[model samples]
Target: MLLEVKDLHASIGGKEILKGLSLTIKAGEVHAIMGPNGSGKSTLAQILAGREGYEVTAGSVRYNGVNLLDLEPEGRAQAGLFLGFQYPVEIPGVNNVYLLKAALNARQKAAGKPEIDAVSFMRLVKEKAALMEMDQSFLSRSVNEGFSGGEKKRNEIFQMAVLEPTLAILDETDSGLDIDALKVVANGVNLQRRDDRSVLLITHYQRLLDYIEPDYVHVLANGKIIHSGDKSLALQLEAEGYDALMAKAAG
Candidate 1:
């Protein structure tokens, strides 16, 4: 398994959020986690990304057979774990290409590899930027500064593509995107799919799935996965709504 989250129970500020949530992702699999607001979907992503503040009261997370909970956020990144934030932050005065090059070099250095040459790094970034359909001017701008919502989301995927993480956890990446931007972002994700890469897409709407097409679809409710099925499950949820599934799970 690329990522295994077993019976995860977490809380924030003394309030329970994740309750016995178990999930597994193998190499090359795309898993879509859909849920209503406050369902702990984002919480699960946060915990997996090694974000602090939320306490992991119980359960274990194994990534590539290692204890993921023991690693720091940067450690996780160096180990090929990437998280695409719902809201990408802006870093003023930091060049986007420069930041990405530094991040890539850091990961390579941690793996005992030599830093990439400037010429090769530029070529890589330009290729990835083209894959994301981003203009060349974006490379000169500050990271995510003055970008629109859709642009930020695209940049997140762009970073993921350049880094080539073994596992990616995207939290509500399609939250505020238009149809055109959504297609562009989804295409970028689809093009980056590799046999050694796994994706965990946390989303609320099935429309994103229409473009990306997950191998597995899971419905998370009240901090638990109440249902799991194939891509058709997303269509079912879209047609019938989460109410019926939530009621059935509760019953």
Candidate 2:
């Protein structure tokens, strides 16, 4: 298994968000999690990303054979875990190239590798940016500064491409994107799929699955995964509505 969550329970401000949730993702598998709002989908992603203030009241999460909860956020990133936030933050005054270099260098240092030289680094940046269809002018701008909703999501996928994480968790990345922008973001994600890479996509709609074609689809409700199936499950959810399935699970 590339990632495992066993009976995971998490709480914020004494309010429990995750209730004995369990999940597993094997290598090369794409798992899409669909749930309505407040289903703890984002909470699960945040816990895996090592976001602070969420208390893990019980259970465990293991990633690449290491105790994931033990590592800090940066440590997790250096270890090849990436989280694409639902809301990408803006960092004024930090150009994209500068930030990318810093992040890449940090990973290199963690792995006892030398920092990439400027020429080689720029070459790499250009290659990845082009892969995501990012314009050159966008690379010099402050990270996510003044970007539209779709552009921010595109930038997130661009970062994912550059980072090449072993496990990439995307939380509601399709929200607020128009069809054209959605296809662009989906294409970037599709290009990143590899036999050694795994993706955990948290989404509300089945449209993204039309492009990414996840190997597994899981339905989350009330902090627990109520059902699990293949890509067909997503279609079923889209057709039958979550009310019926969740009601079935609740029963």
lDDT (0 to 1) per candidate: 0.95, 0.94
TM-score of each: 0.99, 0.99
Worst 10 residues of 2 by lDDT: 123-132
Per-residue CA lDDT of model 2 for 27-141, tens digit only, reads 9999999998899999999999999999999999999999999999999999999999999999999998898899999999999999989999888888988988899898999
Cα lDDT of model 1 by residue, 139-232, tens digit = 8999999999999999999999999999999999999999999999999999998899999999999999999989999999999999999999
Q: Alpha-carbon error at 209 in model 2, in Å?
A: 0.8
Candidate 1 overall lDDT versus native: 0.95
